[model samples]
Structure formats: C-alpha cells, structure tokens
Target chain A: MIELKDVYFSYPSGAVLEGIDLTVKKGEYVGIMGHNGSGKTTLARLITGLLLPGKGYVRVNKIFTTDSERLLDIRRSTGMVFQDPDAQAIGETVEEDMVFGLENLGLPVPEIDTRIEKYLDLLGIRELRHRNIRTLSGGQKQLVNLAAVMVMEPECIILDEPVSMVDARCRKMILQHIARLNHEGTAIVHITHDPEELIRCHRLIVLSRCRVTNQGTPHEVFGQLLDEKKMDVPAPYAISRKLGLSPVLTIKALLEELCRSRSGN
Target chain B: MSIEIRQLTHIYDASTPWETIALDRIDLTISKGTVFGLVGGIGSGKSTLASLMAGLGTPAHGSITIDGEPPDPGRNVGILFQQPEDFFFEKTLFEDMASGLLHLGLTEEEVHKRIHSTLDLLGLDHQILDRSPFHLNRGTLRLAAFATVLTMRPGYLILDEPTASLDPKSRKRLVEVIKRISGDIAIIYISHRLQEVVAVSEYLAVLEQGKVAFTGTVPGYLDWATGQDAWEYLPVLNQVMYGLQRLGFDVDLNVACLEDAVEQIRLSLERT
Candidate 1:
C-alpha cells in the first residue's frame, strides 16, 4: 500500500509537484498520467524513496520515505521499473541480472533459482535467460527489467511507462501479467502516457502543471477528459462517444455494442 | 533520389561463440519524400537494419546505396537513435547544433542559419537554443536532438522510437514534425507503436527474426494484417473494423484515422 498527503516536491531547478494527496490500497491498480515534465516521474521516484519530497511526505507500507533506517524495508515491499531500460542493467546476462536482486535479498539459492525461472518464463523470455544484456533489443531489455523486478515478488510494483518500448504483443503480455499480479493481491501503480493502457485500471489520477487535477474511475476521468479535449483517448472510447453510445474500453466490446444497437437489443 | 538495399546481412560478433545474425538478406527501397515504416518485435533486427542504413557499421554481406552512392552518415543519412538526447554533450543546445555543422566545415553564419531554419521547419522556438539540453524536458530534448540531425540537411532520416517515452501532446507534435519534413527527405520511422507507423508511413516492412515478413503500401499492409488475425499489429480502429467485418458488418478496413472509421461504421449501420 502507498499513501501521500499534501505532497510537495521540488528540484534544484524549480518546483515540480504541489499539494498532492493520493493512496493505493492493497491490490489496488492506480494509473498516473500527465504530459511531459508534468511531475509524473518525480512523483514515482518520491514513492519509491529514490528522492525525498521537498515539502511533504510519501509513505509506502506505513514507512516514511524519509526514514532512511527503514529504506531497505520500503524497497523490499516495493519494486520500480524505470522508463529507460538501459539505465537499470546491473548484470551481464539476463539470468544473472534477475538473480542479482534476489541474491541481495539473501534468499536461498534454490529460492532464487525458482523465482528467476518463474518470472523469466512468465514474461516469455526464457530463451533469453543467458543472453548478454547489452545484446538485447530495447524491448527485450525492458522485459528483462520487469522480470528482474517481479522476481523480487514485492508487495507492490511501480511501473513507469513499462510498455512504451515494447511491441504490441509484448505490451499486451506485460499488461496481462501485471493485471494477473494485481489479481493475486500485489499492488500496481502504472505510470504511462498512453490512455489505452489505463482502460483496465481501477482508479486514474491525472496530474498537470505541478498538481493533481483529476482522480476517479477510468470511465469517470476519461469522460471528463474527453469532454474537455484535454487528453488523447483510446479509439474505441472515442468512437463510442461519437456514435451516441456509452464509452467502452476495448475494440471487442465496442463491436458488441454496435451489433446490439443495430439489432435494437 | 532513393536508397537501395539488396541482400543486406549483418552479423554481430561473427565467427565467435556469441555470433548472432542481426539481419539476413533484407532488401528494400526508400524513395525521397516518403515515410517508410520499419516495425518488428524486440530483437527482430529493426535497430540493426536502421544502423546499417545509417552507415553506422558495415554489413557482413550485401550492399546499400544512397542515391546510388555509399551512404555518408551525417551528410546523406542522419539517425536519431532512441534516447537521442543522451548523445548531446554540449554546454547548450545551440552549441550542440552548431558543433555538428562545424564538423562539416560550414561557416559560423551558415551554421546559425541552418540551426534556425531547421528549428523553424520543426516548429520549435529559438529560445530553446540558450538552454542546456540536459535541463530541457524530454519532448524538447528529443526535438532538439532531431534538430541537431536535421541541421545537417540529410537526404534520409532514421528515427528509432522517437515517441517511446513521450506524452500524447508531445507525441502528436513530433508526428506532425515528421509529416511536415517528410516531403523533402526519406524517413525510416522505426517504432513498436503501430498506430504511429500507420499514421505517418506510406510504406511499411514487418520484420520477424531478421527477415522481412511483409512489405507494401500502408493500405496494402492493413489489408494483409486483417487476414493474418494478428490484431496486435493493427491499430485499435483497424482492429474494431476487422472485428466488425468478422461479425458480417460492411465497414472500410483500409481506413486509418478515427474520423474515417467512424464515418464508415455509421454508413454500414445505416445500410442495415
């Protein structure tokens, strides 16, 4: 679980986030969206304890991010996948990189091996187990990064634009895996710019100009955002609205709706 | 007026234990004033092909010619790699743009003119030149990196996932910039985002395991995709149209933009 109250963060250059209040309960999937330089990444780092807030506080699992003594506990409870995959590499090979975090956690060797195998297989990267990290493509590196984080089996996973570099197949696979993990009671805080990716989120938070401007269910937030022309939305949702029908998330649902309407059902 | 690639193959760490064939016997042609999309799964050799086209490295086999001559990397072909901002090491964006032009033996006046004109062409303001590239936001940094390349006036451009981490507004802006300048230069737009590829490209090549699985005009590829049942490769609007067609609805599958798709769907429903 994560909570932030009246959180205000600033960089040496200037202020980034202001008067933020948010919480993610256990197993809750929250999506954070904003334009570039809108303090989205800054907020993610604050929650992960990578950076301390300048004015207020960020708490994960009831442990304050400012609590340096319990930073390890905070890290164990939460894992973060950064936007850039190249910056997160710590091992030469895929398997080794995955094992690095588990080894640091001091898990038994058998446990570490089991977790590495489980996640690599889950992420569909088993064939890349021994491939050099440098040789992998940007999307492959991103999968490796997710596998490495998931191996830790943290209570919550914070993904920053996890699918941006991946192909459509891999993107769907990663989102499905993340959703499965959330269903299994792991918290998810997905940060992305793509509105389509947030369709499945339980709650959505919109940030802009250093403040929280919107927060609600995906339908509620997307409805208001679309009306305001403030953000780009998924094609299905946009078309449904244009056709005087309730907005839907996926293309399959939109087709069903269209069929039912044509039949007057 | 065009780039010709034939039997191009590139192998990493050749003849060694770590040898991996990055590309294999790929052939393509990119005419000036066209946006050619190169899409594939991760490690499917999209970047490898881009590098080969940019003359970053020699291919293990086959040939590449830009306007019937070997590609001259900065002068004839400019590549904006993923995370291109990382390549900026100058004190300011202006100096960064100037340095590349300076290396080409251009006079200071010419360098300044080129930078300003490129920025104007990209719809970026001159005020950004005074700021450090490091301090600029991701969107601005990307455009600045692009300006650095466009200032050289390359006949061909290679953009690798230019909109990967960009927000929607910035992504739209960059796509517009690509469309605006695509008239004067051939662009190889490499990305995992199929929607963007569909939006900007006239022709597309889909790679699978270092081989070209499909290549044709945008509409031709869309028609091909509908038959493949690989809905992942198609944009959401196309996917909806494909799904409707499966349910026996008469809709236009070749439509790309949402407005056209919506209109097609409306007409289809009214017909029934």
Candidate 2:
C-alpha cells in the first residue's frame, strides 16, 4: 500500500538515495537491509511521511507525502515504530501509551478504550495495561510501542531497527508478534541489521551506497551475499549455500533441505 | 591480574520503598588473558555486575578484588558501557580520548601516538580524530569510545554490549579487535547476543533474575542452557545443529562460524 517512485533524496553533506523506485503491496512483509549510513532510516521516514523526498514522490495509500493537507491521513495509514521504545513512549503506563495514540486520532473515549483493549489482547499484553512504562523491560517497552502503533489500525507499519537493542528472548517474542501481524494482512517494512530478523520476511531489499543493490526473496538475495559482500546474510543461509545445499533462511529449512538430500530425494 | 568477585550483592535505592535488589549473592572471576562473557536477558543485572567489576560502585555485600587488591576506578580497569557515547563530553574526539591520559603525566605526543595505534587496531581512520564524538556515526563513535578506554591500558576491560547497535561492518570490526587484544588484557564481555559472545568468549555465564544461572566454558554453557530449556539465547547455528540432533540427525553441533558449520554439514551429509 506504499510506493516510492523515482525518489531522490539528499542531505546537506551529500547525496543519500538516488533514482529509487519501490512498492509495498498490501499484506507484504518487506525486510530492508543496509549498513550504517545506508539510507535505510531515511527511506522509512520518507514512506511514513515524516520526511519528504527532495525529488520524485513517496506515496502512502495513494497520498503523496509532500502534500501537507493529507500528511495526517498518510501517517494514520502508515504508522512508524522506532528503535528506542523510551524515546517514542509519551505516557506513564502501558494503557496510557496505547490510548495516547488513539486519542491523537481524535477517536471517541469508548472507542479508544476498545481499541486499546483489542490490541493489548491481540499482542497478549493485557496484563501490562497498568504497569509503569519505566519499569518495563526493554522488550516489554518495545511491545508496548508496537501495541500503541497497532492500536491506531495502520494498514502498513514501518519498523526502524526495533529489535536491535532488545535481548534475544524478547527479540524473538517481538518478531513472533510482528510475523503474526504481517500474516494478519498488515504490510510491514522492517529495517534491521540482524540476520535472524530477516528470516520471516517475504521479500528482502538490500540498500548500499544510496541505491538498491539487491531485491528479491531472502533466498535469492542472500544466496549472493557471500560473493557480493554488499549486505550481511544469515549464518545458516551462508553455511547452507557454501555446503551446496539450498539457500534456506532458517535452520529448520536448512535441515529439511539436508534431510531431503541425505534421503536422495 | 585476575579480577575476582566473591558473593557480590547489590540493591538499588536500598532501604527505600522503591528499593530493588539488582544483584544477589553472585560470585564470579575473570582471570587475565581470558574473555569472560556474561549473557542474560534485560534487567538481569548484567550492567550492574559490569559496573561493580569496573569499580563504578561498591557492592552492598561481599567483595571485589583486582589481583587480590580492592578496585580503583580508572586505574586498573576500563568499562565500555552500552551507548558509551553518552559518556563523552569533550568537543573533539582527540580531546575525549586524551581525557584520561593527561592525568597519567603522558606527553601529548605519547597520547597521540597511543590513540593513533589504537584507532588503527580498531580499523578506524585517523581522519575522525578532530571531529566531535557526537558528530560521528554510531559505529565510529563506538570504536572511538573503545579507543578512549583502551588507551588507558587497563589490566582489565569490561565491555557491556559493545556491538548492540552497531551495523554488520562495524560489528565485525569490533569483533576482530576484541579477538586481537583479548590475549593481553582480561575482558569481561556482557551481551545478550549469543553469536558474538560464543565467538569471543572461552568462558560463558548466564544470568537469570539477578543470579548466576550457569557458568562454564562455551560448549558447556550451550549444553547446560539447552538442557535447562534456555536455548532460546543460543546463536542460530547452535540452535540449528542442536535441533537437528533432537530430530535424529547424525550431525555435530559444535561448529562456530558459518565456515565450520558448512564443513560439519558436508561431513554429515557424506556419512549419510
């Protein structure tokens, strides 16, 4: 439901993204991979209407990001979840945080409460409704942020390295929730440096030196990761590729492929 | 010098309503020329333990000794906190790196020489020396922070999630440098990322709820964590091989990097 057509962006120091054209259809999971200073964050900001492109267009739900009149509507359709939970959280409690976003949408009080309950239940964090935001764990806070964003009912969610600082257990938990949301038909544009986080994505886009160097399924793009050296591939995938096995993203898939090969099938 | 912690316990804001026990009767030791990895979930007191080890604060209970001596902050130990850029204050990176060295009576030339050598080891260009630490990118800033700490030439170094927010290139660079300097200086590596921990550390400890849950070598820690149903934090390769064994695959799971894993898989396939 998001598109960037011939987008060119630059900073005062130098050029960032150039001649970029991309589209995210409804219910698609797009994993954006890039190194530091690789314009991944800028691309996400452009799609969410937080930063307008210097050239070309960034459209969300057919609304141009450059259009000030419909900027609010664009943001309402595509919510952004940042890396640090403490920075985005404005409320003192979990319920308050979720409700704060809903209130911003100017929804009725009862409707806001209903939305908060629905998302907390959906994400299975209903028990944390009254917990103090500061006391919550990093993963818990990130989940609260996701809940807050999802409570707004955005068609597409753009997450910018949301799990980079989270612990392994909590990272898995958050990824599971995101996977579920994507399965539920919410388009996701996930910007991450973690290879494990890229496993469940339907499509992988690798950005380097301000251009899209690789774009395809995880298998297709990561198969060349070793040779290209443009982006980092998951260890299992790299190992599988090196071993002449199928370039599988997850360990289970790699084992399945190995088992099939062992069985001569 | 070996750093030792005997029955260490610390409580935040003790004797108050908000008093919380951050650490509890934890005992550990880090010998010289050893890379000790501390793995745990968030708020498992990993940072608190690192602080105690660095002599940032006194333990509420028990004791810590550096080579059988009490801890002296900024003397024999250096700590690289997560987001260490927050610890920077000087206008320029050179000034920040030289902040702790001037007190040692080292000449400006000696400080500059040491900083350049350390930056080279860290794979950082010397061009960023004049720039503000805050102006540099996150990856460069992290290495710069490490430079500031390592220049102190502490006998012991405590790195708290050094690679947490770094990109792949930067993470690889840091990992290489950690491996390079690990032989001369004792390191207490604390991180939730098991891949880096398993790669860098010979000794691994798991912290669960402010207590030492498991402590041993890398392979032993993996087996213990797996047996304890805490394999969730193991690196993907370890988890995969372990899963294969659980599924009746005749494969070795002790491989480290992607290359070793590939060799192991190939050998397993050849046997089958």
Candidate 3:
C-alpha cells in the first residue's frame, strides 16, 4: 500500500513537481504516463524512497517514506526496473546477478538457489541462467533484471519504461507479464510514453508539468486524448470507422467485432 | 542535387559472432527535395540505411553519393539518431545547437543568428534557450534534437524515429516544420507508422530482413504494407474495415484518417 498527502518536490531549476497528492493501494496496478519531464519519474523516486518530498508526507505500506528506521523494510516491499537495462544488472553472469539481490536481502543459501530457479522460470529466463550479462540484448537484459528482483519476491514492482528500447515481440511479452503479475495480486506502477503499452494498463495516470493531469483506466484517460484529437488513434482507424464501432484500441478486438457483426443472421 | 546508392552493404560488428549484414547489395536513388520514408520492424536495418545517408556509419561495400560526394558522418550530413537523449549533453539549448557549428568554423555572431532562427523555425520560444537540455520534456527534447542537427545546415536532414514519443500537438507542428524545410534539403524520415510516412513523404522504402522490400511512392508502399498486418501498429479503422471486407463485407481502404471513417459511417447510416 502507498499514500501521499499534499506533497511537493522541486529541483534547482524551479519546481518540477509541486503540490501533489496520490495513493496506490495494495494489489493495485497503475500506469503513469507523460510526454517528458512531467515529474512522473520524480514521483516514482518519492514512492521508492529515492527522494524525500520537500513538503507533505509519503507512506509505503503505512510506513513514512522519510522514516529512516522503516526505510529498509519499505524498500524490501518494492522492487524497480529502470528504462536502461545497462544501469541495472550489476553482476557479470545472469545466475550470479540474480543471486546478488538475494544475497543483499540476506536470505539463506539453499533457499536463495530455489528462489533463483523459481523466479527464473516464473519470468521464463531459466535458459539464460548461465549466460554472461554483456552477451544479452536489450530485451534479454531487462528480463534478467526482472528475474533478479523477482527472486526477492517483492510485493510490488515499479517499471519505468521497461520495454522502451526492446523489439516489438519483447514488448508484447513484457506487457503480458505485467498483466499476469497484476492478476497474481502484485502491484505495478508502469511509467511510459507508448500507447500500445498504455492500452494494456489497468489504471492510467498522466503527469503534465509535475502534477497529476489525469487518472483513470486506459479507456478513460486515452479516451480523453482521442477526444482532444491531439493524438492519432491506432492503425485500422478506418476499419473501426466502417464498422461504426466506437473506436476499439487493438486490432484483434476490432477484427472480432467485425466478424460478429458481419455474421448478423 | 540528387542522391544515389549502388550495391550498398553494411555490416555491424564485422567478423564477430554478432556480425550482422545490415544492408545487402541495396541500390536506390532518391531525388532531392523530396520526403523519403523508411519502414521496418526492429533490427531490419531501416535505421542503418538512415545512418548511412546521414553519414553516421560507413557503407562496407558499394558507394553512396549526395550531390556528387560520399556521405560522411563527420560532415555534410545532419543526423538525429533514434534515441534523442544520446546526442544531447550540453547544458543549454544554445550550447547544444552551437556545439556542432563550432567545428564548422562559423563566427560567434553567425552561430547566434543561426541558432535563434532555427529555434524560431521550430516554434520554440527564446526563453527555452537558457533551459537545461535535460529539463525539457520528451517532446521538447525531440524538437531540440532536431534543432541541434538542423543548426549544422547539412544537405541531408535525417531523423530516426523522429516523432515516436512525441504528443499530438507537437507532432503536428514538427510535421509542418519538416514539410516546410523539405524544399531545401533531402529529408530521410524513418518511421514505423506507414500512415505518417504516407502523409509527409513523396518517396518511401520498407525494409524487410535487411533489404529494401518496397521503394516507390508513399501510397504504393502503403498499399503493400497495409497487407502485412502492419505489425499491429496500423490504424484501428483501416484494419476493421479491411478485416470485414475480407469476410465478404463492403469497406473502403482509401480512408486514411479517422474523421473520414467516422463521416463514412454516418453517411452510410443515412443512406441505409
């Protein structure tokens, strides 16, 4: 669980995020979106205890974000995967890397090995266990990063553009995984600019100029974006138009709708 | 002032296990002052082709000539690579744009004039001149990236995934700028979306498995590309209409924009 009350954060170049209020309950998956420099990442840091709020209070699992004594416990409850895969993955080998976080958590040795395999299989990275970190591509590196944190079995994960640099296939896989994790009762806060991924999120939030511009399910937030016509709808816009369907987001859904309608017996 | 390529081949990580033959005996010509669009899924070498044109990378074999000279990364070509954050490092917009021109041997006053004009052309206010490059949002970063490259004034202006992360308003503004700027330089605009390419480009190329699969007019390429499922990023209305028609329903493939589709549906309803 997370809670923020009347928070304010600023950098030297004026104020990045000011007078913010937010809350993320346990087992809730939220996606945060913005164009850029929208204070989305700043908010992420505030939640993860990376930055102390200049004003107001942030609570993770009922513990204050600024409480030094509760910092380790609060941090243990959440794990993060950044946009750049290279920045994480400190270990040389995948298996060793996965175990590094476990070691820091100070779990027992045999249990650590079990967790390594368990999460590696959970994230589908078992085959890459023995590979060197540098040999993996951008997507593979990200998967390993996921596996590493997952072994610790944190209650929630905060992913900042986890699939930004990845190929389309991997992007789909990661999005599906995020959905699955959310279904399994793990909270997720995904920050990204890609709409294809945004459509997959359960609840979406938009940050503009460091304030919560909008918050709702993907349908609500992006529906407003479409209404503004500031952004173009996905491909097959014409197909939806012909069918007179209310602008479905993905192609598969549109196809299904068309199939059902054309069979109008 | 025409562009020509003959048997262009590019290899990445040559001789290593990851040696990828990016471009393979590709030959093509793009007339100057035209929008040439490029498309492909990831690792298809579309970016590689742009890099070659922008002079960021050398062709392993064959030749590329722009205005009768080879494409040189260090000179003559202005390239905005895929990741906007990669090429940016300076503190201020002025410094970022001036970094490239300092080597071109321009006078200080000349650099200032060029920088201000380019910023104005991009519709960025002069106040943004003093802001940190990193402080700007993704859309601003993208425009700043373009401004930085355009300040160099190369014969060829290239942008890889130029508008990928941009919002709608900025995207429209940037597209307008590109259209206005195209008359003076060859624009090698690389994007995955066939629709955007169709809207802005006179010429088009689709990269598949490291080669040019389709190269012709934008409409011609889209006609072929729309059939490939468009990697699922293709517009919603187009696919819906096409899928319905595939199942023996009536649908028009000519509807490029969403409003036209909406109007078509409402009109069809009245007729029915």
Best by TM-score: 1
Please, what are the lDDT tens digits per residue for candidate 1 over residues B55-154? 9888999999999999899989999988887888888889888988899999999999999998988889899899888778888898888888988889
Worst 10 residues of 1 chain B by lDDT: B11-20
True contacts kept of each: 0.78, 0.57, 0.29
lDDT of 1 by residue, A93-184 (tens): 88889888988999999998988989999999888888889878889899999999999999999999999988988889899999999999
Better of 1 and 2 by TM-score: 1
Reference-based lDDT, each prediction:
0.90, 0.83, 0.74
* Model 1 stretches astray by more than 4 angstroms: B13-18
Query: Candidate 2, which segments miss by more than 4 Å at Cα?
Result: A91-99, A107-141, A226-229, B12-20, B57-60, B68-72, B85-91, B99-110, B132-135
- Candidate 3 overall Cα lDDT vs. reference? 0.74
Per-model TM against the reference: 0.97, 0.89, 0.82
Best-fitting candidate, measured by DockQ?
1
Q: How many residue pairs clash in each candidate?
A: 0, 0, 23
**What's the lDDT for residue B58 in model 1?**
89
Per-residue error at A189 for model 1, in Å?
Answer: 0.6
DockQ head-to-head 1 vs 2, winner: 1
For candidate 3, the per-residue lDDT at B80 reads 82
